[model samples]
Target: MQHLRVAWALAGAAAGFFLLFLIQAHLFGEGQLVAGTCEIVTLDRDSSQPRRTIARQTARCACRKGQIAGTTRASPACVDAQIVRSRQWCEMMPCLDDEGCDLLVNRTGWTCAQPGGRVKTTTVS
Candidate 1:
């Protein structure tokens, strides 16, 4: 009976630790980070090949209200006023090796997908 009790206690503690880990990921995952690169590629629009990169700007965190991780928003994420940077990524067709680039949330942003439709990160910016 004592051995069984010890086993149960250990199991319970492990479960508790796993639960906390999940909660932390939800509240402060990489998605919540106010950082990402934005690029402007020169797409042929009619071609099914890789596009050329024309312009790129160093971006700053410009998250909207309540976009930060965790329950508390310590400071608002703002962008540089002097620079005109894209708010989202993949503004043009940048997919390579016959991959596809699909826009998200309408035509606001875009992402590269493999032939199997799985998203693959080709470039950070």
Candidate 2:
């Protein structure tokens, strides 16, 4: 009977440890799994803004056959392709004196210095 009790206790402890391990794996392992590159082909359009957010900026990677990763904005006649490998935004800047600029997959905020003591904010989408 004593042997049975010890065996049961050991089994319960093992099960508990396995459950904790699974929980930790689920929380931390999933995020690490999603890191990789994304290859995309940009569609040509006459409009200044690209169709998608990823289409607006150049990705960071080696260009092959006239296709590069860093062609973020393309001309209406230029059909650009890129691969965005990283999840973080490529660039970030201030929109204005008081506004904060953040560049994301779909939106890019720009702050340009004017001739005078003024700054211009431009949002590229």
Candidate lDDT (C-alpha), each: 0.45, 0.42
Runs in model 2 with CA error above 4 Å? Answer: 32-124
Give the per-residue lDDT of model 1 (tens digit) for 1-125: 99999999999999999999999998987644434322222323233446533332233343444342110111122433221144343333345656666546644445677777567433233
Q: Tell me the tens digit of each residue's lDDT in model 2 across 1-125.
A: 99999999999999999999999998887424222223444443345555423224323343345432332322111123332223222232223344433344354544445456454334443
- Would you estimate the TM-scores of all the predictions? 0.34, 0.30
Leading candidate by lDDT: 1
* Candidate 2 CA-lDDT value: 0.42
Against the true structure, candidate 1 has what lDDT?
0.45
Please give the clash total of every predicted structure, in order.
0, 7
Off by over 4 Å in 1: 34-53, 56-125
RMSD of 1: 14.5
